[model samples]
Target: MCKAFEEWQEECIQKGEIIGALKTYKKCSFAKEETLKNIITDFSLSEEDAQNCMEKYW
Candidate 1:
């Protein structure tokens, strides 16, 4: 489940809060989708992850 974290990374950079997100991602040991979602949620920000996936893939 080694998906690209580019979108999540961009989001973090845009929010100017990558420190915590990096910490959490590392803490979770980078468990793919769930951890990514956790990172998104941990920031208390909203991103349509599923929609982004669909738009990018489908």
Candidate 2:
């Protein structure tokens, strides 16, 4: 549960980042590898985090 505003903001930001990455992958024709790389690098997320997003959304 998002008990605080800060926690809610963080949750929203994470979801937004994941959705944005997927959108770019679809709309910009970024290769799968490039999208994964960008998600990790551009979003400052870990390899595991990026992979999890791919597993769920890609």
RMSD of every candidate to native, in Å, equals 11.4, 2.7
What alpha-carbon RMSD in Å does predicted model 1 have with respect to the real structure? 11.4
Instruction: Provide backbone clash counts, one per model.
Output: 0, 0
The TM-score leader among the candidates is: 2
Question: Tens-digit lDDT track for model 1 on 1-58?
Answer: 3346887777757555545555555576775566556646665545675335323432
- Mind sharing the TM-score for model 2? 0.73
- How do the residues 30-53 of candidate 2 rate in per-residue lDDT, one tens digit apiece? 888888898898878899988888
Model 2 worst lDDT run, 10 consecutive residues: 17-26
* Per-model lDDT: 0.54, 0.83
Q: What's the lDDT of the predicted structure labeled candidate 2?
A: 0.83
Deviation (Å) of 5 in candidate 1? 29
Clash pairs detected, candidate 2: none
Residue 15 deviation, candidate 2, in Å?
Answer: 1.6
Off by over 4 Å in 1: 1-16, 48-58
CA shift of 38, model 2, Å: 0.5
